[model samples]
Target: MKVTKEEVAYIAKLSNLMLTPEQAEKQAEEFSNILNHFDTINQENLTGIEMYSFEDEPLRLRKDEAIPFKNSDELYANTKSMQETAIKIPKVVE
Candidate 1:
């Protein structure tokens, strides 16, 4: 699955890319190598492989606990504009 210069040019044109002659040649070589790697992988034998959706063991998650913040007012003390409980930003559209 070799990518030719003409193929690279066509791809670049379709993608709306501005590629120099050198860049196009380099990209073609890289793309060809990637396709060759995929071809090599397709030649492998995986007769009894188990597909994994998650880790083998169940994950231990932390218990949900409410932790009170100390000096919470300091976080919003430097705001230029704010409501009673939230920061305010200017409207973008009229």
Candidate 2:
């Protein structure tokens, strides 16, 4: 469960992040602690526990419907970034 600084650095690179050495160390400690917490949960005894089921009552999902909103102009007017009808977002993919 010991997350190394190298692993954190690799993950940061994959995520397009530029983290300092201090930040990477802090992230490594945080990740290791999270893994340790999961390890503690896995060690719990769960014998003779009746598993909960939803067979008695089936969930009913409502039909999806599109309702037109009238105040969209006010919402779109607040943002300066726009590309025709859609909002212009910054490209993040490397």
Candidate 3:
């Protein structure tokens, strides 16, 4: 797989990052190299590998529980605008 400058620019835009032409080019190359490394790893063969397991019994897990925050007002005290519950911030996405 290869990474393009346009793809880098698009990702930067989505992440609210300002990258110069040089930076974008460098990022694209770096991303392409990283992807190539993963590709290399994927090409390895493990045909004779043996599977390892600790236990056959079903695993036990703790019950999921909902715990509410103690001081919600204090949490929202520093926000500029609050619409019912969520704090409002500048829209970064188009």
Candidate 4:
């Protein structure tokens, strides 16, 4: 799983990156090392290992509480322009 400089350059181009020749070489070597590590992981024996499983009982989740902000009135009061409940802003886009 050796990564080449050309492949690194291609990846850089796809990711909108401008890598120097040295940087490309370094990245290629680093990527190759990463692939080698993956290859090493693939060669491991985990036949006796059990997969993760959730409990039979339903998962308990915290209630989604809505805490009201008290300073909303003060925020709107400081604004010069407000439409109804929301603060008004000038449109910048066409």
Candidate 5:
């Protein structure tokens, strides 16, 4: 799983990346380490692990209830601009 400088250059060329020699060497080492780590993980045995769809406990949700509030007419009475039941703003497009 060791990435060579030539391989790194090839990959960079395929990806349309322009890397300096030093950067290509560094990236090659990084990519090699990542591949090695993935290979190590793939060798692990997890036979009885349960797949989690969510956290252990179920989530608690608030009840849907409508609450009364002050009327919109009184709220918008002090505003300079308003429409039938909404705030009005100046048109930006011609």
Candidate 6:
């Protein structure tokens, strides 16, 4: 499963990637090494391995509670400017 320079170049072209000759050669070597690692993994023994599952654990969630605000004056006290009942911010777009 060793990746060739030509294969890498073809893949880069298909992906619209602009790679120099040196970069393509380097990427090809990297891809070949990765494929070799996968080949090694495929030869491992896993006869009695138990598949991992997340169904046994209970999900801990916080209780949603409603807290009341003191007043509008207290909330808007730190604003740069304010209209009748809302905070006034500078215009961002035309």
* C-alpha RMSD of each candidate structure in angstroms: 7.7, 3.9, 4.8, 7.3, 11.4, 10.0
Residue-by-residue lDDT tens digits, candidate 4, 41-77: 7888989887865667777899999988889888678
Which candidate's TM-score is highest?
A: 2
lDDT of each: 0.87, 0.90, 0.91, 0.90, 0.87, 0.87
Global CA lDDT of candidate 4, please? 0.90
Clashes of 4: 0
Give each model a TM-score: 0.42, 0.63, 0.52, 0.45, 0.43, 0.42
Question: Which portions of model 4 show Cα errors greater than 4 Å?
Answer: 44-94
Give the Cα error of residue 78 in candidate 4, in Å: 22
lDDT of 2 by residue, 1-94 (tens): 9999999999999999989999999999999999888898778898887798778999988889888778888878978898767998888797
Question: Against the true structure, candidate 6 has what lDDT?
Answer: 0.87
Model 1 — which ten-residue stretch has the worst lDDT? 50-59
Worst 10 residues of 4 by lDDT: 50-59
- Alpha-carbon runs more than 4 Å astray in model 6: 44-94
In model 1, what lDDT does residue 94 have?
95
Better of 1 and 6 by lDDT: 1
| Candidate 1 per-residue lDDT over residues 1-94, each given as its tens digit | 9999789999999999878999989999999999888898678897888777467688789989988877778878998888976889888789
Question: lDDT tens string, model 3, 68-94?
Answer: 989999888888999989878889898
Model 5 gets an lDDT of 0.87
Q: On a 0 to 100 scale, what is the lDDT of residue 82 in model 3? A: 99
Compose the digit string of candidate 6's lDDT tens values, residues 1-94: 8888889999999999888889989999999989988898778898888898668987778889877787978887888888877777778898
Candidate 1 clash pair list: none
